[model samples]
Target: MKFPKVQLALVQMRDAGSKTASIAAATTWIERAAAEGAQVICLQELFATCYPCQAEDHTMFDLAESIPGPTTDALAELARRLEVVIVCPMFEKRAAGVYHNTVAVLDADGTIAGIYRKMHIPDDPLYYEKFYFTPGDAGQPRASVGPDKPNGFNVISTRYAKLGVGICWDQWYPEAARLFALAGADILLYPTAIGWIDEEKEEFGAGQLDAWMTSMRAHAIANGIFVGAPNRVGIEGRVEFWGNSFIVSPRGEVIAKANSADDAIVTAECSLEEMDVVRTHWPFLRDRRVDAYGDLTRRFID
Candidate 1:
C-alpha cells in the first residue's frame, strides 16, 4: 500500500488556569503547527481541563462532557478551518455517574470520525483514574456497540492518516499498540499527562522517564508504525509534570522532542513508506508464532 509522508505535530504545554485559557492556548499552538505544515496534530490528554486524575473528587465529574458536546464541536470547527487531523483527549460524560477517559479523532473536514475510550484505568497513589473512568470494553474485532463490543477501540480514518489513539496508561501496554497496528493504524498517538511525584523524584525520576520513553519507542519499532506522544508540562500540586513530548519513527528514531520545562510545539515529517521497509527487514510479525502464544491470555503461567 502506498502512503504519503505526513507532518506529525505534538503540542506540549502546561495547563492554563481555566478551560477557556487552555483551549485558546492549544488553538494557538495548533494554528502554529498548521502554519508550519503539520497535517496531523495531537494535544496532551485532557487539554481542555487540568489533570483531574490527581485526586478523586466529585467536582471533577462535572468536568466530564459528552463526546459531541461543546468541546468536540469547537474542535471540529477548528479542525475544518485548519484542515488538520486532530486527536484530542477529554473527560467524557457518557451518562449520569458514568464517565470514561476518551479521545475523539477529528478528520481534516472537521467531522467526528470516531472515539477511543481508555481501556486501562490505573489506580496508583496520586493518579486516581479508576475512580472516575469506566474501562472501555474491547470485544471481538470490529464489533458493534452492543454488550459484545462495549469499549471498542476505534481506528479513525481521515484524509491525512489512520490514527490509533490511546490515553496515558494505555501507552505502557504493548497489546494496545499491536491491536491497533493489526487493525491498520499507521500512526499510534498517545495523548498523555504524566509527571514525577515530588517525593519520588529524588529517587526514581530518571529511571521512570527512561522507562516511559523506552517503552513508547519499542512500540514504534515493534509495530513498524509512527508513535506520537504529547505530554503535559509544569508542576501541578505534588506532581511535577515532565514535558519531553516526542515523535518516534518506525525505526525507533526520535524525530522531535520538546524540552522538559516549557510550552512547545514540535513537528516532524514521518515517512509512512519507511514502515514497509522496516517491517520487511525486521519481519517480526511475519515470524510470529501465533499458535504458541496462548499463554499470553493467562493471568499467570504458574
Candidate 2:
C-alpha cells in the first residue's frame, strides 16, 4: 500500500464569537492535532465563522472572503510549517453577488490543492443555505475526479491520502459518497455543523443525531472506505451544535468518537491496507450496474 496507515484527526469546536477568534482557535487546534501525530486534519464546516446562514440577512455576506484571503493564507502557511494536510472550509465570496460554501484543501506544502463547493443546499428552518450559496455548477460533464470535474463531488489528492470531502448537507447523499469513492478517494471526510434547534430538541433530537451517524457509516460500508465526520459543539444562536465528531472504518464501525457537547479532537489511525482487504471481500463496486442508473440525474421520473 502507498500509505500504510494514516493518522486522521478532526477539530470539533464552537463559535468563538468572531471570525478572527475562531480562526485563531482553529489554528491552535491544528497545531495541537499535528503535534498528536495527525497526518491529515479536518476542521468543522465554516471554521472561521459562526454558522452565518441561520438567516438570510444581507449583512452575513460580510463574513465571506475569497479563497486566498486571510483564512487560507494563515492555514496554508501553517500547513507548510506543520507538514500536515488541512481541510479548511470557509464562506467563499466569489464575486460581488456570488458566494459559496467551499472547502479549500491545503496540501502539506501549503499549496491549495483543490476546492469543492457545497452542492446540496438545504433550506430548512435555521439551515438556510440556498439564499447564501449558489448550487455548484462550475464544471464540465464528469467521468473522473479533478478540480475540473463536477465542482461539488471531488476527490483531492493530498500528501497523506486522497480525500473525498463533502459539506454538512452533502453527507446524507449516498450518490455523492459513491462518486467520491469511485474517483479513488481513500477516505471520505464530511466537515459539518449540525444540531437540534431549541424547539425541535424534545421531539426530534435523538433520532436526528442517530440518522446523521447511520447515513455516514452506511457510506463507509457500502463503498469500502473510511469515513470521518467532525462536527461543532455548544450553543450557537437558536441551535446547539452537537459535537458528535467521529471516525468509522470500512466495515462501518466507529473507531473513534467525541461526546455530543464537548470541545474535542477526534483522532483515528486509518489503515489504507484495510481498504484493499475490505473492498476485495465486499466487492460492492465490482457488482455495480452503472449502465442502468441514468435516471438518477432526473428530478422526477413521472
Tens digit of lDDT per residue, candidate 2, span 1-302?
A: 26789999999999999988998999999999999999999999998888987888999999999978899999999999999999999999888999998899999999988888888899999899999998775465555545434355768998889999999999999999998999899999999989999988999999999999999999999999999999999898899998999999999999999998778899999999999899999999999998999999999999
Q: List the residue pairs that clash in candidate 1.
A: 137-151
Candidate 1 residues 152-260, lDDT tens each?
A: 5557777878888899999999988998898788899999999999889989999999999999999999999999999999988888899999999998999899989
The lDDT of model 2 is: 0.91
Q: What shift in Å separates residue 295 of candidate 1 from its native position after superposition? A: 2.1
Badly placed stretches (over 4 Å) of model 2 are 138-150
Predicted structure with the largest lDDT when compared to the true one: 2
Clashing pairs in 2: none
TM-score of 2: 0.96
lDDT of each: 0.88, 0.91
lDDT minimum window of 10 residues, candidate 2: 141-150
Per-residue lDDT value at 91 in model 1: 91
| Model 1 poorest 10 in a row by lDDT | 142-151
